[model samples]
Target: MERSEPARHRGQTAVAVVLRVLAAAALSVDAVVHARLAPGYQAAAPGGLGEGNLFVAEAVAAALVGLYVLIRGSRPAWVLALLVAGGGLAVLLLYRYIDLPAFGPFPAMYEPVWFFDKTLTAFAQAAVVILAAAALILHRRTRRA
Candidate 1:
Protein backbone atom coordinates (compact mmCIF):
# COMPACT_ATOMS: atom_id res chain seq x y z
CA MET A 1 0.00 0.00 0.00
CA GLU A 2 1.20 3.47 -0.92
CA ARG A 3 0.51 6.48 1.28
CA SER A 4 -0.47 9.80 -0.26
CA GLU A 5 2.03 12.65 -0.26
CA PRO A 6 -0.11 14.80 2.01
CA ALA A 7 -0.56 11.99 4.49
CA ARG A 8 3.14 11.34 4.60
CA HIS A 9 3.86 14.98 5.08
CA ARG A 10 1.36 15.21 7.90
CA GLY A 11 2.88 12.22 9.63
CA GLN A 12 6.34 13.72 9.38
CA THR A 13 5.13 17.01 10.75
CA ALA A 14 3.47 15.28 13.69
CA VAL A 15 6.62 13.36 14.52
CA ALA A 16 8.71 16.53 14.34
CA VAL A 17 6.32 18.38 16.62
CA VAL A 18 6.31 15.60 19.18
CA LEU A 19 10.08 15.37 19.14
CA ARG A 20 10.40 19.11 19.56
CA VAL A 21 8.09 19.15 22.55
CA LEU A 22 9.79 16.22 24.25
CA ALA A 23 13.28 17.57 23.63
CA ALA A 24 12.34 20.99 24.89
CA ALA A 25 10.71 19.61 28.01
CA ALA A 26 13.72 17.44 28.78
CA LEU A 27 16.07 20.38 28.33
CA SER A 28 13.88 22.48 30.56
CA VAL A 29 14.13 19.86 33.27
CA ASP A 30 17.91 19.86 32.91
CA ALA A 31 18.01 23.62 33.19
CA VAL A 32 15.83 23.67 36.28
CA VAL A 33 17.83 21.00 38.06
CA HIS A 34 21.12 22.75 37.36
CA ALA A 35 19.81 26.10 38.47
CA ARG A 36 18.37 24.66 41.66
CA LEU A 37 21.63 22.97 42.59
CA ALA A 38 23.98 25.76 41.53
CA PRO A 39 24.02 27.54 44.86
CA GLY A 40 24.74 24.45 46.91
CA TYR A 41 27.42 23.31 44.48
CA GLN A 42 29.09 26.69 44.61
CA ALA A 43 29.29 26.53 48.39
CA ALA A 44 30.58 23.00 48.32
CA ALA A 45 33.25 23.55 45.65
CA PRO A 46 34.33 27.12 45.46
CA GLY A 47 37.10 28.09 43.06
CA GLY A 48 38.23 30.71 40.52
CA LEU A 49 35.24 29.73 38.42
CA GLY A 50 33.08 28.06 41.00
CA GLU A 51 31.22 24.87 40.14
CA GLY A 52 28.01 26.67 41.06
CA ASN A 53 28.73 29.32 38.45
CA LEU A 54 29.40 26.59 35.93
CA PHE A 55 26.09 24.99 36.79
CA VAL A 56 24.35 28.30 36.30
CA ALA A 57 26.00 28.67 32.92
CA GLU A 58 24.87 25.21 31.91
CA ALA A 59 21.35 26.00 33.06
CA VAL A 60 21.29 29.15 30.96
CA ALA A 61 22.55 27.36 27.90
CA ALA A 62 20.07 24.55 28.33
CA ALA A 63 17.20 26.98 28.76
CA LEU A 64 18.16 28.91 25.65
CA VAL A 65 18.54 25.81 23.54
CA GLY A 66 15.29 24.40 24.81
CA LEU A 67 13.50 27.58 23.91
CA TYR A 68 15.00 27.59 20.46
CA VAL A 69 13.93 24.02 19.82
CA LEU A 70 10.43 24.74 21.03
CA ILE A 71 10.16 27.70 18.70
CA ARG A 72 11.86 26.17 15.70
CA GLY A 73 12.43 22.48 15.28
CA SER A 74 15.06 23.00 12.64
CA ARG A 75 18.26 21.10 11.97
CA PRO A 76 20.43 23.80 13.49
CA ALA A 77 18.29 23.94 16.61
CA TRP A 78 18.55 20.18 17.01
CA VAL A 79 22.33 20.39 16.63
CA LEU A 80 22.61 23.01 19.35
CA ALA A 81 20.34 21.03 21.67
CA LEU A 82 22.39 17.89 21.05
CA LEU A 83 25.63 19.69 21.83
CA VAL A 84 24.33 21.14 25.08
CA ALA A 85 22.79 17.91 26.31
CA GLY A 86 25.73 15.72 25.24
CA GLY A 87 28.30 18.04 26.80
CA GLY A 88 26.41 18.29 30.08
CA LEU A 89 25.85 14.54 30.24
CA ALA A 90 29.50 13.81 29.55
CA VAL A 91 30.67 16.20 32.25
CA LEU A 92 28.19 14.81 34.75
CA LEU A 93 29.24 11.20 34.19
CA LEU A 94 32.93 12.01 34.16
CA TYR A 95 32.72 13.90 37.44
CA ARG A 96 30.56 11.21 38.92
CA TYR A 97 33.11 8.43 38.41
CA ILE A 98 36.46 10.22 38.14
CA ASP A 99 38.08 12.77 40.42
CA LEU A 100 39.68 15.17 38.01
CA PRO A 101 41.54 18.18 39.34
CA ALA A 102 40.54 21.67 38.36
CA PHE A 103 42.63 23.40 35.72
CA GLY A 104 42.60 27.06 34.80
CA PRO A 105 39.52 28.76 36.29
CA PHE A 106 37.38 25.66 36.71
CA PRO A 107 36.70 24.14 40.10
CA ALA A 108 37.28 20.55 41.09
CA MET A 109 33.81 19.01 40.67
CA TYR A 110 34.10 15.39 41.56
CA GLU A 111 31.16 13.63 43.13
CA PRO A 112 30.92 9.87 43.26
CA VAL A 113 27.40 9.83 44.58
CA TRP A 114 24.01 9.90 42.89
CA PHE A 115 21.51 12.15 44.58
CA PHE A 116 18.00 13.20 43.54
CA ASP A 117 18.96 16.35 41.68
CA LYS A 118 22.00 14.75 40.08
CA THR A 119 20.02 11.73 38.97
CA LEU A 120 17.18 13.84 37.62
CA THR A 121 19.52 16.07 35.64
CA ALA A 122 21.32 13.05 34.26
CA PHE A 123 18.07 11.51 33.05
CA ALA A 124 16.84 14.76 31.56
CA GLN A 125 20.11 15.38 29.76
CA ALA A 126 20.10 11.85 28.39
CA ALA A 127 16.53 12.28 27.17
CA VAL A 128 17.42 15.49 25.37
CA VAL A 129 20.37 13.80 23.69
CA ILE A 130 18.22 10.99 22.40
CA LEU A 131 15.39 13.22 21.30
CA ALA A 132 17.70 15.71 19.58
CA ALA A 133 19.52 12.93 17.75
CA ALA A 134 16.23 11.53 16.55
CA ALA A 135 15.02 14.92 15.44
CA LEU A 136 18.24 15.51 13.55
CA ILE A 137 17.78 12.26 11.73
CA LEU A 138 14.18 13.07 10.89
CA HIS A 139 15.16 16.49 9.60
CA ARG A 140 17.96 15.05 7.53
CA ARG A 141 15.69 12.52 5.92
CA THR A 142 13.05 15.12 5.23
CA ARG A 143 15.60 17.34 3.60
CA ARG A 144 16.94 14.55 1.45
CA ALA A 145 13.47 13.59 0.36
Candidate 2:
Protein backbone atom coordinates (compact mmCIF):
# COMPACT_ATOMS: atom_id res chain seq x y z
CA MET A 1 0.00 0.00 0.00
CA GLU A 2 1.14 3.55 -0.71
CA ARG A 3 0.46 6.35 1.68
CA SER A 4 0.40 10.10 1.01
CA GLU A 5 0.49 12.97 3.48
CA PRO A 6 -2.71 14.87 3.90
CA ALA A 7 -3.25 17.90 1.73
CA ARG A 8 -2.24 21.21 3.26
CA HIS A 9 -4.82 23.73 4.40
CA ARG A 10 -4.54 26.63 1.97
CA GLY A 11 -7.21 29.04 3.14
CA GLN A 12 -4.78 31.82 4.03
CA THR A 13 -2.88 31.55 0.76
CA ALA A 14 -6.13 31.76 -1.13
CA VAL A 15 -7.11 34.81 0.87
CA ALA A 16 -3.78 36.48 0.22
CA VAL A 17 -4.02 35.90 -3.49
CA VAL A 18 -7.58 37.20 -3.57
CA LEU A 19 -6.64 40.29 -1.62
CA ARG A 20 -3.75 40.99 -3.94
CA VAL A 21 -6.01 40.72 -6.98
CA LEU A 22 -8.66 42.94 -5.43
CA ALA A 23 -6.13 45.51 -4.35
CA ALA A 24 -4.70 45.58 -7.83
CA ALA A 25 -8.15 46.04 -9.33
CA ALA A 26 -9.00 48.79 -6.89
CA LEU A 27 -5.80 50.65 -7.65
CA SER A 28 -6.44 50.35 -11.36
CA VAL A 29 -9.92 51.76 -10.94
CA ASP A 30 -8.65 54.57 -8.77
CA ALA A 31 -6.07 55.38 -11.42
CA VAL A 32 -8.71 55.61 -14.10
CA VAL A 33 -11.02 57.69 -11.93
CA HIS A 34 -8.30 60.10 -10.99
CA ALA A 35 -7.28 60.56 -14.58
CA ARG A 36 -10.79 61.00 -15.91
CA LEU A 37 -12.93 62.21 -13.02
CA ALA A 38 -10.75 63.78 -10.34
CA PRO A 39 -7.71 65.43 -11.79
CA GLY A 40 -7.99 68.25 -9.30
CA TYR A 41 -8.07 65.88 -6.38
CA GLN A 42 -5.07 64.03 -7.77
CA ALA A 43 -3.04 67.19 -8.21
CA ALA A 44 -3.83 68.53 -4.77
CA ALA A 45 -2.54 65.53 -2.87
CA PRO A 46 0.62 65.79 -0.77
CA GLY A 47 2.95 63.80 -3.02
CA GLY A 48 2.69 66.52 -5.63
CA LEU A 49 3.06 63.68 -8.14
CA GLY A 50 0.00 62.98 -10.24
CA GLU A 51 -2.25 60.50 -8.50
CA GLY A 52 -3.19 59.00 -11.82
CA ASN A 53 0.40 58.21 -12.65
CA LEU A 54 1.06 56.80 -9.22
CA PHE A 55 -2.01 54.62 -9.19
CA VAL A 56 -1.30 53.39 -12.70
CA ALA A 57 2.14 52.30 -11.64
CA GLU A 58 0.71 50.60 -8.58
CA ALA A 59 -1.93 48.84 -10.58
CA VAL A 60 0.50 47.61 -13.19
CA ALA A 61 2.88 46.27 -10.60
CA ALA A 62 0.09 44.59 -8.71
CA ALA A 63 -1.33 43.05 -11.82
CA LEU A 64 2.03 41.59 -12.65
CA VAL A 65 2.21 40.12 -9.18
CA GLY A 66 -1.24 38.69 -9.59
CA LEU A 67 -0.17 37.09 -12.83
CA TYR A 68 2.75 35.49 -11.07
CA VAL A 69 0.41 34.11 -8.44
CA LEU A 70 -1.86 32.61 -11.00
CA ILE A 71 0.73 31.02 -13.27
CA ARG A 72 3.36 29.83 -10.82
CA GLY A 73 3.29 27.34 -8.03
CA SER A 74 2.92 28.52 -4.47
CA ARG A 75 6.58 28.56 -3.37
CA PRO A 76 8.05 30.94 -5.91
CA ALA A 77 4.86 32.87 -6.30
CA TRP A 78 4.49 33.27 -2.57
CA VAL A 79 8.02 34.61 -2.30
CA LEU A 80 7.34 37.21 -4.92
CA ALA A 81 3.97 38.01 -3.41
CA LEU A 82 5.51 38.47 0.01
CA LEU A 83 8.08 40.82 -1.41
CA VAL A 84 5.40 42.87 -3.09
CA ALA A 85 3.27 42.99 0.03
CA GLY A 86 6.27 43.90 2.18
CA GLY A 87 7.25 46.70 -0.15
CA GLY A 88 3.72 48.07 0.04
CA LEU A 89 3.80 48.00 3.82
CA ALA A 90 7.11 49.83 3.83
CA VAL A 91 5.81 52.52 1.49
CA LEU A 92 2.66 52.96 3.53
CA LEU A 93 4.64 53.32 6.75
CA LEU A 94 7.01 55.80 5.17
CA TYR A 95 4.11 57.92 3.99
CA ARG A 96 2.18 57.76 7.23
CA TYR A 97 5.05 58.14 9.68
CA ILE A 98 7.53 60.28 7.77
CA ASP A 99 6.09 61.99 4.73
CA LEU A 100 2.79 63.17 6.18
CA PRO A 101 4.18 65.49 8.85
CA ALA A 102 7.23 66.41 6.84
CA PHE A 103 4.97 68.00 4.27
CA GLY A 104 2.66 69.43 6.88
CA PRO A 105 0.40 72.47 7.01
CA PHE A 106 -1.59 71.09 4.11
CA PRO A 107 -0.88 73.01 0.95
CA ALA A 108 -3.03 76.05 0.35
CA MET A 109 -3.86 74.54 -3.03
CA TYR A 110 -5.67 71.64 -1.43
CA GLU A 111 -8.77 71.55 0.71
CA PRO A 112 -8.51 70.42 4.34
CA VAL A 113 -10.74 67.45 3.71
CA TRP A 114 -8.46 66.30 0.93
CA PHE A 115 -5.49 66.17 3.26
CA PHE A 116 -7.43 64.19 5.88
CA ASP A 117 -8.85 61.88 3.27
CA LYS A 118 -5.44 61.11 1.82
CA THR A 119 -4.06 60.47 5.27
CA LEU A 120 -6.85 58.03 6.02
CA THR A 121 -6.33 56.37 2.70
CA ALA A 122 -2.62 55.87 3.37
CA PHE A 123 -3.32 54.34 6.76
CA ALA A 124 -5.92 52.00 5.35
CA GLN A 125 -3.63 50.91 2.52
CA ALA A 126 -0.89 50.23 5.04
CA ALA A 127 -3.23 48.05 7.06
CA VAL A 128 -4.05 45.98 4.01
CA VAL A 129 -0.39 45.60 3.09
CA ILE A 130 0.44 44.51 6.60
CA LEU A 131 -2.34 42.00 6.58
CA ALA A 132 -1.19 40.59 3.25
CA ALA A 133 2.38 40.21 4.46
CA ALA A 134 1.36 38.43 7.64
CA ALA A 135 -0.98 36.15 5.80
CA LEU A 136 1.67 35.21 3.26
CA ILE A 137 4.15 34.43 5.99
CA LEU A 138 1.64 32.27 7.84
CA HIS A 139 0.66 30.49 4.68
CA ARG A 140 4.26 29.78 3.75
CA ARG A 141 5.13 28.33 7.11
CA THR A 142 2.01 26.24 7.20
CA ARG A 143 2.72 24.73 3.83
CA ARG A 144 6.31 23.82 4.64
CA ALA A 145 5.40 21.01 6.97
What's the distance in Å from true for residue 90, model 1? 0.1
Error of 2 at 37 (Å): 8.7
lDDT of 2: 0.49
Question: What are the clashing pairs of model 2?
Answer: none
**lDDT (CA) per prediction:** 0.92, 0.49
Which residue pairs show backbone clashes in model 1?
none
**lDDT string, candidate 1, 1-145, tens digits:** 9899899999999999999999999999999999998998888656557999999999999999999999998889999999999999999999999999988878788899998989999999999999998998898898898
Q: Residue 80 CA error for candidate 1 (Å)?
A: 0.5
Candidate 2 backbone overlaps, count: 0
Which candidate number maximizes lDDT? 1
TM-scores of the models, in the given order?
0.96, 0.45
Off by over 4 Å in 1: 45-47
